[model samples]
Target: MDGRSLWRGAVAAGITLALGIGNASASFLVPQTALPGKNVPKYRDPLPTFAGSRVPATSGYTVSFEEFKQQVLPASGGFGPTTVWGYKINGNGPLWPGYTVEATKGSPATATYVNNLAGPGGTPPLLQKYLTVDQTIHWADPFKLRCMFTPMAAGCFDPYTGPVPAVAHLHGGEDKSDFDGGPEQWFTPNGMRGPAYRTYTSAGAPPAPANGAVYNYPNGQEATTLWFHDHALGTTRLNVYGGLAAFYFLRDDRDTGRADNPIRLPAGDQETEILIQDRQFDTAGQLLFPDGFPSGLNGAPPNPTVHPFWIPEFFGDVIVVNGKSWPYQNVEPRRYRLRLLNGSNARFYNLAFIDGVLRSAPIWQIGTDGGLLDAPVPIVYPGRLLLAPGERADVIVDFTPFAGKTVTLTNNAKAPFPSGMAADPQTTAQIMQFRVGTTVTGDTDGTCDPAASKKSGNKCVLRTTPMVKLATAKGTTAPGVTVATRRQLVLREIEGGGGPLEVLLNNTKWSGIMESTMGTTNTPVAGSTQLVDYWLTELPTLGSTEVWEIINTTGDAHPIHLHLVQFQIMNRQPYQANKYLSDWMAALTAAGKGPGDGPPNPYATVLTDTLSIGGQNQVIGGNLLVTPYLQGSPVPAAPNEQGWKDTVVMMPGEVTRIAVRFSPQGNPIGGSVGYSFDATDGPGYVWHCHILDHEDNEMMRPYIPVKP
Candidate 1:
């Protein structure tokens, strides 16, 4: 059967596949057996690399999304090319995990992104045949289907086969809100636009076309490894899964991407990027995604009554890195810098290198999602590098010790994070291989050598120049900075009879009455701690510092990411989740807010009723503070997480605290300073769970910065 026929057959049979889900029904599922990951030769394909302009340029960089054929599974596996949608840079052939774009600090760089996913004469692309767009979720709604307005509405459960909507979001970028590429700022190739769509043009630059967006990045922050990907509403998981992501490296004088620089870190050919993701393929060598099928490993959607095709989480059996499955890189026995990014939709990786039976090498962590750390963190055996979805880690590994030996990179982290199913030994557990060459060339160990580092006055003496420390110590605030406010936020899940209907951040929806009531009038409700109106909750004064305590009431761990600014991880403490949730429900009941209370609003999608606990002044309701229910003293951040970070891991039953300053990372504490660009304008920014599945739901919130 052809690819389209196989997709239709799979959907019609409601067949599910594996990756911790139950086994598929052999009689009904289209593909009786998938290509076993072990059947594909390890280290068969060489890792691919691409780099952008090092010097600053304004208008030369252009990236577009187009459909192409790629060898995802090797030809030896008896599979043909897989059709995918990938980024084509500067009119070149499209590539998955597109080329890396480099920029210098304090200078500006601009790029134009075009949406070309439509086929001949503007028809739906062929890749759509494999995707089952869940219209029940709040999405771009390019055709204005408004499926989310009513449960099981007509066409709500059908796959979307129209022009694809896309917008480029530079993760961890400190740019203006217009260039943030928020969920509502998406645009399609067929002249369809989202509600908050707006293109930014720099001074002396041309205006953007109707099908594209021009964005300027004022590289004012410290040097860090940032990435760009699609952020279209609801369908982010689908868009990114179809290959639409690239790297953006911001550099400064201190940490230049050169060997001769002061840092003397690994550079040029010695440095490489390793992006890890999970995927599943069909018998025709085509990408396969679960569409809430009832049989096989995928099983049925947890809450099929509410959402027909939307699953809580997705886990693939095969691991792919740099566009190839089970690929390897031949490296000399010398130190190399590996910029690791976890781009999976939901899986978390506890990565480590093993040679034979023993651990191979110690990983020296130098930077995180934001920028370089104060000192290198030595990660030895038993302590693997844990990276959740959308998180990045900059580390150095010296292969000098294991000359001529083969080292295997492995992952032990479970699916669904903290407490989920273990990785399959033959497939997801093994990431890639490194065949270390016996001959060591250019094996110079500079200041970046971990052995040369020692403790000095509460800091490591690895660098001649000092990095601006975000805090005196983990969980402690930066010295002399006065906090403006302290807020308690909640991560909650609304469940149905089958499973999770939707996960919410602060018990609110993406759009509707709850969001509209924020930053407006105020009135106290009778005999309740809840108020009729509350000032904007997350809107912080530009350049002001605040402490946000995130209370996770769910059973799983979540990777919470904040856009625009990188903050310091304060600490995490255990709490009585059940007690806190009971009290929270009581507060909502007292305030006359139930699951489906109040009158319906035609304008609202998910929050038509007064079901929200509302934003701002969360402590007012029955003094719902996490401090009283704390189970123990706070634990400081891990050694690897002592630096500035834009994304953090929030564990279950714990209150994770973070100190956020609504300004650039280099800004001095205690001073009110804003970015060079206007961050207060446009559609603002959002903080959400990096799990694309949860993010597509309501597990995201928008925050704007206002001038003090």
Candidate 2:
């Protein structure tokens, strides 16, 4: 029989023979009373923030991962404490969504991260029960790397229950590649490390402990809202879901994060950082994740024979903010600067402030993933701010007019983004409530007000210093710089009998040999005998400006993010997706390669023998130009997206264009000027879809910067 028939037969026999051995007690839906909104207080303070160790002056900060318990659900609900794997700041708290690391712009900061997941005696912690590590995908397989050969191997198909591996990535931080925290830089509690793992200790910095790595950050970029999270190879989704994330604030003289600073923005008690996420829990308040078992709450896997317990996407019913389940915060009747972050694994949020049926106040977006925009974009009533996973927004919300009223922070974005199911009104739609204090406190609305009457001339005076604009709305380069090269990339999904089996960027896998469109073979690493190496493509010259045209043929939109530099959105134009896909397939067939010869070629081999189909070309070198399939005029970026961004949304059936300069945003637009640190060194950076599920799959790709 063929592979498909064999898979079907095996699934049927397993379900019939071992029906009771799987996750039978799992619940698909969480009860309302278990996590009612506004019951818990919002977690704001990152108690005793990481203040660099003074004993060893060069030892910037030290943090470690440890197991802890927190009351996720209320005591009246009869749910016990939930176990969490969290980061501790100087042994103070193993707090969920760990404490913020505050750094100055020009000063350099060094951090030593210790992998202490296996507590005291190197024993696995209680949080291990909530982890479901799918070995089928390419991950930090510390044991044998069996999956590198074939998924049918016994070691590859089973769950990984060994010492967990972890790596910390400072999302949106423009640092050296050694400290960028790429996927292959993982380390385990037992002193095991990945192939690309490297440790750096500046001049007099303290040495890293056993099973630890030290990273140094020059803090050379613009002041922005950046975050740090677990980014181990395939287990990023699980590690981050287990509460291994925290905020990292980069402050400068202009936006000093204090009220008396040059920008005159809200500070101290008037400013707050809010992290919004979605999660599910069992009846006992323990975290519940889908394992793709036939008899489990989540049904059978799409391709059971290939992957026993890997799902396409995950969406939880309950909304969580700042480590609390639908929590609330009481605020005074004045302007407050709220730095928002969407930390969910897959869920996208379109947030607004609603008082009953009407939007209560305007949300003025002053900054994006990179830094402050040229001017504030007013999101008035009936408008919502969209934030995908790993995206951040800095906004000022004036609550002066809504005194003595309760306003709810609501979400209306669909799951899986544009074309997915709508958010339920009673559950995922309502994020949190803001109970405005009845009394007017001692606060003043800043000079940058959102009201129309406060506008100077035609535009609202949001800032005194104007940010550098990179591109105009007409899709032309700004006066100073010119595009060095235009690269075209494609996003696609591979389907199985049940649903999506996996996704790929440019129809290539994470490792192995790939043939470019120019009929030349290029491997990620040169002369490497390892199972997996950096699958390098799209090599751009250091200090050069390039325009990347991302063509998305998939059904859903994806949030694309780059590691080293923040980019400018040029435009997005609709295209003929079907024609483009057909042409791509034809190009693959003409190259004398089998349909199932892409990355994870074994799975494709099985499909080709059984289904008689082919995959797209694993092309690089030359661009898969989109000009022939273009349909309409290009649409300019939204007002809020005009600023410097490290992540931007690419809609389906459209070609989204972005101009990226491989340097800090404050630098001049053109020439051979690079970063404060070496731009071409260590394991290079990566660009991938922000959807953690997609990123964990084959949707991520690495690129190196070559010094000119």
Identify the candidate with maximal lDDT. Answer: 1
Model 2's lDDT to the true fold?
0.72
Tens digit of lDDT per residue, candidate 2, span 433-511? 7778766455455534655464454334545666666667576557776666566677888787888777777666565
Candidate 2 worst ten-residue window by lDDT: 606-615
Error of 1 at 331 (Å): 0.6
What would the C-alpha RMSD of candidate 1 be, to one decimal place? 6.5
For residue 109, give model 2's deviation from the true position in Å. 0.4
How many backbone clashes does every candidate have?
3, 1
